[model samples]
Target: MKNLSLQWRITLMTALLIGATCIFMNVLIGYSGRHYMDSIGSHITGYEETGGEDPDFFDPRRERLDQELTIVIHGAQESFIATNWYITAAAALLGGVLAYFLSGHALKPLRTFAAQVEKVQPNNLTDTKIPEAVLPEFRQFSRSFNQMLDRLDSGFAAQRQFTGNAAHELRTPLSLMQAQLELFSAEHPEVSPETADFLRLLREQTERMTQMTKTLLEMSELRTVPCTERIEIGPMVEEIFTDLAPLAERKNITLKATGDGTMTGSDTLLYRLLYNLTENAIRYNRPDGTVHIAVAYEASCLHITVTDTGCGIPQPYRESIFQPFFRVDKSRSRENGGVGLGLSLAWEIVALHGGEIRVAESSEKGTTIAVSFPTDASAD
Candidate 1:
């Protein structure tokens, strides 16, 4: 069937090829056997025509020539038939077995390559040594895989440098503003109500700036961090809900945490994971709409689904939603007060945690994002 896996497909194809070759050989041998039988029958007929008996005409005359000729013909027929069947069957079975093993041996390097790729971490990505192989097929695969790793290592290094530079640059201005605000407030102890309100607005803006800067730095760190620690994901989801409930309440968005979300990863990354989903839910939700957080295990993987009763993400932009600085509606995203890095950070965090985040479904009704984190059994 078309849906069969690669190993089975390879084995089946090999077996079929062997079977076809065996059938072809058998046909050839059958034809030869028929020719041999015909030649012997003609020789006997010629002897009968030339002499009174086949013995007189045949080489090395015998008393019972007809009987001897008939016995020889029967023995030849049986031997040819038996040999033909035995050789064909033996060749077919041997070819099939040989094919199966050869196919497996040829693919062994690929299997090892895949396993090596799975264990690659950002910190150790520079170590891209794939074991050598004498076979050309494996050698080519190794070269390509190493090339890809080289590119990834360079890309991640560049990203780290950029993140470090950006975070410092953004933080410097906020730090200056905060210090200036403290000095101004201290000096203007007798300031008027209007001036005080203005000062408060400035302080609020500075605080928001500081929070946004910290979130950006955290996102950057998440990229470089190897989440070696295991975390209880259910409690993490519950904690995130508890922390963000007030914000949802302020917007009249009801947030509900349901199911048990148990997975393995860093607590910080898990926090970010829940935060991004909840924030998206709250930002996109309609007035008095509900945001449901469902966390459960499925197929030996932890499934954390965030469903929101909001205007769904457009089909065209669903993939782009995870791109940095990408927003469905610029004005709406601006009104929501995010720089459009929420989903991007979420995606990176999930990826770093060795999980997959995807839009399971979306429609005019709402959107559902399903995140799958491998269980301990799976991770091993």
Candidate 2:
């Protein structure tokens, strides 16, 4: 909706064109005037210098007449030049003003088209009908933009459908597993302690699998959820710290959070983003190391940084770390009980909120991952 964006570059070009034309026109007019004056002055001076009407007679009185005639010709030439100069100056001024206004009027349709495009929301993105623009040449461009919107809307719909179906399918098996484990445990109290312990571990693993499946399904659903809610980011960060403190303590790691501010986004998504970030920091930290969480409101974004004194990610693999199923050290990932989707989910959540998440810095010293969200977006 800005009045003077790069889309109006054509306006500047039009002004330049008008300026060049004015300069060229003035130059041509001046050249013609000079030619006319030279020809007329030479003929009159020649006639006066010759006493006879013939081409070759010379006299003292005739020479004096030639001087007078030259003066008069020069005065007339000056008057003609001055008049033309005024006319040309007025024409140049008028042209410049006319060009400026004309350029703005010509670009008005483009501005309206862009404003319409900006008004599109995710829910209505599937609609392919773009508002008609005044300029015929822009119709094709409008069609292409609407087509892209349709494809994106279809993509998000598909993702949502897949997640819904997958969650339904997984719930049945998860329920059966829980029932079987409960029956087995209830019927086997008379068994040896080791056998009981084994059954307990089996039950635990099954529950873990259920939790993982549910988290994965939620992560998939988060992709399609419109992030239009307002969030008190400071409180959200506090809640994450409270939730993960016990887990960090179990690993002999100290987890801490600092800074307080509000940001815009879905509360569920913001929690997920912070959870993944903090969990990674704690999981990767060395024994008894410190994991730091900081939140600060910057110029236009709310920044959350998670730093850990862990086995830092190598420089070569930083770019790939946010990709699903990507692990710098596969064995290390297994040791940390990671499926390599945590950061990927975090990345998607950040992107859904029109923000960004990345490993801002990494080395043997430590690694710092920053997740940022726009401060203007409301958190749901």
List the candidates' TM-scores in order.
0.71, 0.70
Model 2 lDDT per residue over 1-380, tens place: 25765534554565567666766876788678778877888887766546357666556777787778778777877887777677766766676677667767777777777777775655457543575564688878877887888788889788768876887799789879999989988887698999888888877777766766776687767756766676776778778878988988888998777887676567787788888888888888888999888878777677878899987898888889988778888887766777777888888777667677788998887899987766555222
> Candidate 2 clashing pairs?
229-378, 229-379, 229-380, 230-378, 230-379, 231-379, 264-377, 265-379
Worst 10 residues of 1 by lDDT: 54-63
Would you give me the overall lDDT of model 2?
Answer: 0.76
Off by over 4 Å in 1: 1-101, 111-129, 133-136, 178-212, 223-230, 377-380
Query: Residue 133's C-alpha lDDT in candidate 2?
Result: 60
- Tell me the tens digit of each residue's lDDT in model 1 across 1-380: 78986666788787788778877887788788878887887787677666655443545444377567767777887788778778877877887788778878877777888788887866457564686664786787777777887898889878877876788798999999999999999988999999999998898778767766776787767655656676766687778878888888888998787777445567777787788888889888888988998877788887889999898988899899998789899989766777778888888787776678899999888899998877752332
RMSD per model, one decimal = 6.0, 6.1
User: Residue 327 error for model 1, in Å?
Assistant: 0.7
Candidate with the greatest lDDT versus the true structure: 1
